[model samples]
Target chain A: MPLYYEKKHQVQFYEVDITSQLTLSSLLNLVIAASGEHLEEIGVSSEELISRHLGWVVTQYHMSIKKMPEKGQTIYIKTAAMAYNRYFCYRSYWLYNEDHEELIEINSVWIMLDLNTRKMVPSDPEIMLKTGAEEIRRPQKFPRIKLPKEQLVADKSYFVEYFNIDENEHVSNAHYFDWMISSLPLSFIKSNHIKSLDIKYEHEILYHDSPKSYVHFNQENNRSYHKLANGNLTAAECVIQW
Target chain B: MPLYYEKKHQVQFYEVDITSQLTLSSLLNLVIAASGEHLEEIGVSSEELISRHLGWVVTQYHMSIKKMPEKGQTIYIKTAAMAYNRYFCYRSYWLYNEDHEELIEINSVWIMLDLNTRKMVPSDPEIMLKTGAEEIRRPQKFPRIKLPKEQLVADKSYFVEYFNIDENEHVSNAHYFDWMISSLPLSFIKSNHIKSLDIKYEHEILYHDSPKSYVHFNQENNRSYHKLANGNLTAAECVIQW
Candidate 1:
């Protein structure tokens, strides 16, 4: 049997941004939902993980966008677990339009965490076996996002509200993208399109924490570096290519 | 033939707030989506509206909530057009849990606008005939939400970003609710459940406008009145009951 899983979704009206294109944050939401469904199919559901005092946390994501599907379009998302090590699992995701044209490709790394200890833990052996996770090495290396060493071009604070937190009691990853992009001027976002993105989560921003985002743009390279900080500590960093 | 149109949806993880219950803003989104689907079934789709240079704008809403659904739960949303006059259309919506227990009841008024003139217009005769809309008066009169005349308990400004704008090039009504609720103390939202809400849209908040929300809470009546203002002009007013 094939190890990959697929799901079909119609882009809702609310998912589109002002440009009438699906927003980057909503796209990530779809990707995460697809991953959750895939895990459930492999008998590694969230409830099962919680029962074991474990939870899955995404550590890194590298994605390339060819085109953004518009509102009211039907898209297909496919994902699979490529490999698993002691403490981390590698997965791949692809989104395509109704015409079977590829729209985006994403690679993500997830670490299993012990809920009580809040430390990385080895994957359960049963999960690997059940999902038929093979040790296939990825052709392309994951991007290592670098933090900006220069002065900040834009900075803004985002108060963690009830809507931003998720089941894990932390700000959802999608909101990280939201805060990063929202820090830029509306004119910049309206004039440019995101070509690629690489992000790494260094730490978690808990509920009631007001995280601030600092951004630096390299106009020559059409790239932007972002650092999301909770007070003095950096919570996450991201690099975006326009 | 039944006048109501119903749709089934599973509450996604991203829809839930920190408390693991569906956020009130997401609930309104579901209701709007159901209404759109019902409109399409009766030959009045967004595309049709655009072709005729006409659009639907929400003018008022009064909603009563008994409970909120948890993530992963299946809920049914039903909506129907109740009546239409020269300048407004009345609609009703209900949300039900898996057991068929009603969770929410909403009544809304929509004004059809001439997209070119930006003025209120009469409903198309064919639309009324196709939907079999009848002039049935509501049992409970729609509340006239009063603007806060007292001291402001909380005030904050939100910049209209690309993600907040909708297909009509204006901030969607759902985002207004989001900003209003997000402005409240997280502690208050976590401890209290929303019992009812009455809101009126006095003006449209357009893109690139930074609107500020002013709130006044009356502890005795468990009511909070809010006014969303763009500079010196008020855009919308709402009264929330907890």
Candidate 2:
């Protein structure tokens, strides 16, 4: 078993929405940063990886939520690299309250990209060993996400700004989640709490790309299907169980 | 002298821009939240103030920046309620490095508002007393700000989203700073760092209000004047020295 890396965070007022609950995108960003810190402690800093012309890109996330962290709530974020195959690395993240009760669980898929070529590259076993993740022959399967076939319920266009781009010079993955979730109606967002989320990123969005986020809500299943697209090209697709 | 409350913060990755330096708006949010915590600790919580149909609204800010915080850098945030007159209260904030070197200093004006009537109210000396601040007879003078009269350089329309609103049911004040700064050209933002900033809030922007951010740049002075307006009505105005 891989050793879990843990970090503590107190939810700030600015991180929450009007409902006093932490925004979904902010929660994801916190956990992702924790993972980055974990890698830094293990001597595999993102900067070092970038210097080597390689970087980890998240392809998918499957999250199960017990309770969304609220403003001023202190929680522990834990992450570990579970296993890796030739092309994909499997990782897990958990959020727990101070009392040690799990608040959220997430399983994610990451693949190394040759930054110079912008193509998938084989996993570096030497680096994976440093993270204490076991080598696996087969990649783990994540939940499949499907956009609803029904008519679109809402859509909003987002003009990418300089702040949206990270050090990678591309729109950060978590902001896509923000755009997707914010596309829904305020009434629907206030009345519902997300129980689970499954998202798959298909394309990288660069600055100056004005992507439109579309949402389709399935009332029968309490599910919302979302798609973020730059013109006709889909950038991300997500399914949220409310 | 008022007691200064100090808070320690390690800049998170998400708080920084592509250049790895903290965003201007994020820095404001961090310090503003620190002030909220300071109020909470003083037993004059914002919630209690709101419950009494009272709220503190920031009217103006004058900031001098020595350096912007960078990602992964830990710094100290300090705030103090300096003094209050009949209507306006003066407060100061400082950001310091670990060596106690001052990085940023800000002077701000705040006014008490009657939330139910949405009108200005007299200062609540009882609440001010708890902060260990003095009751001065006269208000402190802040630097005057004037918008440039030159032709408009850039204008961008922003649609307020659900997440933009805070617990107060209005667009969070710090977000206005984001919109103003983002309206400038990315090239300019990348090349220049703000030396000082003076901003005044004129009106509040609500959800569904599509405000246009306009910028006027004075090339001779390296200054940018900004205004956010809904149609012809102004919401906020700012001037930044680079």
Candidate 3:
């Protein structure tokens, strides 16, 4: 039988990085959207998943970036069940190029929740089985860290805009990091994929005047920092592992 | 029967003013992307749109925006065939609210191409059927005017970054306008959707110093001017119709 979910997308020129490769965030968006479409084909959808008071929220994901595809290159995405326990539903994702063996793999875990109440709940066994994704027996340990402080780092001045705002009505989480790294000269950004990132959303940022941004990174520890200036608005702190 | 040859989409957040209404170029992108998607589903795609060494290119389009949408509101987009003559394939579009009353309407034409040759081609019957989006016949039309030489009227500024650069290795067309508008004082960008615009691509603003952006608009003619300046790099020009 054909795979239950498969999508081939052509990278648009708008989705490329400075070096002309697809950015990590763009790849992530494509993967998630493809998964959402996959769920829809298998009788589940983000809209229904939330409406049924059954939501899948990412608790933790440890991803490794090996390489990125170039702009205009077509890529295929395939997903399957890894395994699941009562609390953690494990899933795996594969990214492939034209030849099909060129694959990038990801192992991720999600928690089921009661949307209205915003409470955690175990996976629905019947629902999980119907989807037929491979389930993993052992859950991997998530990278541990201290509580990220919401503070400014790089005192670089900048202006924020409308496109940075997402459906959530604030500057998107991904856009913040994009701003942080883009602040560096283009040559520096062209060679990076933001190896790892840990961010804590402390306060919502509103659209304002001459918005300011700060960045801090320790090449030794491989950690980066981002802090936005929104007076009275809660500050956001992010930790980038690259 | 379910429609096979076409689909319609509304002008929403990504394409609209802060009021959630529509912008002129965004109105163009909305129909272009949607219609392109429809064509691709049927085995024809923009990638294959070029023939005779010529590809379809947007030489120019003019629109007059009378109204736009409000934030969190829904808008309707109806697209259909206008007319396909020798040199250009005409297409038409309209925007409406939930009540079905019209908001903004447009009519534009695209040239047939020979991609390899970078030259024009006549609309052959097979080519027209493949890329013309011929199913819907009742598209709307609105008045258009001559765009000014420069879109930069009132002079506000913005900085270019990695994300601002698109696959073309240049600032994305839409983004130039997005930053120009967003850089405006909050009082100006408060609306959710944009009404109308007259823009022209003056130069390809490259990713150097991530150039600075400038904006000038006279609200009187609904005439606005936007410029992307990185010292000497004047990346683009746009005129807005209030």
Best by TM-score: 2
lDDT of 3 by residue, A157-188 (tens): 55445655554445544455565666566666
lDDT accuracy of residue A230 in candidate 3: 65
Q: For all the predictions, what are the DockQ values? A: 0.67, 0.76, 0.29
Model 1 spans > 4 angstroms off: A136-140, B136-140
Candidate models: Cα lDDT each: 0.83, 0.89, 0.59
Weakest ten-residue segment in model 1 chain A by summed lDDT:
A132-141
Docking level of model 1: medium
Judging by lDDT against the true structure, name the best candidate.
2
Candidate 3 residue runs with Cα over 4 Å from true position? A1-4, A49-60, A80-91, A107-140, A145-152, A155-160, A192-242, B1-60, B63-156, B167-169, B180-196, B203-242
lDDT of 1 by residue, A1-242 (tens): 22899999989898887777889889999999998889898888989889989888888999999998888899999998888777778888999998899999998888889989989897776887777777544433687787666766547777776567877778887878878887787778877898999998888888779898899988889898998989888788899999
Mark the 10 consecutive residues where model 3 chain A has the least summed lDDT.
A145-154
lDDT comparing candidate 1 with the true structure: 0.83
TM-score of each predicted structure versus truth = 0.93, 0.97, 0.62
lDDT, candidate 2, residue B41? 90
- For candidate 2, give the lDDT of residue A6: 98
